[model samples]
Structure formats: structure tokens, C-alpha cells
Target: MRLYIAIPCVLLALVFAASGIAGITRGWVLPENRHRVRRLRLYGWGQLVAAVALCRQMLFSTVLSDPDTLDPHIREWGILSGGALLLTGIILMGVSQRARGARQGTGTP
Candidate 1:
């Protein structure tokens, strides 16, 4: 069960990190607000960091322990923190995409 959850999280983390890197290097920007590029880059950085933290908590921390033997507190903290970061990364990415689309007149809100 944990493996199932971890697999998807790892994949998302990779994607977030990759997209963030591309945004940072390529300077993804909106036409309506050139100054907003800085905010977008910051969002990218946030997503990248959140993704890394999520992956670490979900994959590395959980992998070594037997489910039965794992401490509840550790498991709770890992899941809580990982989930929070994952949610944050997803939200940031979504906001960036929407901002881009809105600027491009793609009807995104």
C-alpha cells in the first residue's frame, strides 16, 4: 500500500522538479506581466523544493521500516509533511499554469 502511494509521489516529484528546472532555466513568463516572471520562477522553486521534500519523506523514510515495526509518530509525520508538500507543489504548478494561460488568452481561470 505504501509502495503504491510512494510510486506515484515519486513520479510527480520528478515531473515537478523537471518542470521547475525548465521554468527556471528557460525563464517562462507571461506576456501580460513580464515582472510576474520572477513570481513564476519563485513558484517553480517552491514546487521543486516541495517535491524534493515530499519524495524524501514518502520514499526514503518509509522504505526502510517494516510496517508493523514502524513508529506511528514517524509514519504520521512523514505522511502529513509529505502530503502537505505535495499539495503545495501541485497548487503552485496549477497557479502558474493558469496564470500563463490567462495571459495567453486561453480562457483559463
Candidate 2:
């Protein structure tokens, strides 16, 4: 059961980190409009960091004991912190996007 859950968590962490790095490097993270998007890079980096932390927690828990029945505290903290970080990164991205949109719509540049 734990293995099943851990597998998906790790996969998601990898995807998040990869996508975040791609977004930062490719410069396609923002909208098509060339308006000011504050903290876009920060959000991307945050996602990457969050993904790393998540993976670390999962790995640590797995190493501490049998993957099938790891420590509940570790699992709980990992899931909670990881989910919060993901949400925070996404919210930052959204805020940046909204800023860009506002600038574009208002012709503020």
C-alpha cells in the first residue's frame, strides 16, 4: 500500500520538477502577451525545490523502514508539506499570470 502511494508521489515530484525547470528555461511559462509577470521564475524554482523536498521525505521514509509500512509521521508530514508546497507554487504562478493579464488588458506593459 505504501509502495503504491510512494511510487505515484515520486513520479509526480519528478514531473513537477521537470516541468518547472522547463517552464523557467523555455520562457513559455507566462501567457502569450508580453506583459510584466512578477516572480515567474521564483514560482518555477519553488516548484522544483518543493519537488526535491517531497522526494527527499519519501526517500527518507522508505529508508527508515519497510516500504510497505513506513512511519506514519513521516508519511503524514511528507504528504502535507509536499501538497502545501505544490499549492504554494501553483498559486504563485497563478498570481504572476494574473499580473501579466492585468498588464496586458490595461496596456500597462
Please, what are the lDDT tens digits per residue for candidate 2 over residues 1-92? 36776788899999988866966776545354336556567667766777877786676555445556666787677667766766776666
Misplaced by over 4 Å in model 2 are 30-37, 66-109
Name model 1 segments beyond 4 Å from true. Answer: 1-5, 29-38, 60-65, 90-109
Clashing pairs in 1: none
Report per-prediction Cα RMSD to one decimal.
8.8, 6.5
* CA error at residue 90 for candidate 2, angstroms: 7.7
Q: Provide the TM-score for each candidate, comma-separated.
A: 0.54, 0.52
lDDT measured at residue 91 in model 1 versus the true structure, 0 to 100: 70
User: Considering summed lDDT, which 10 consecutive residues are worst modelled in model 1?
Assistant: 29-38
Best by TM-score: 1
**lDDT for residue 1 in candidate 1, whole number 0-100:** 41
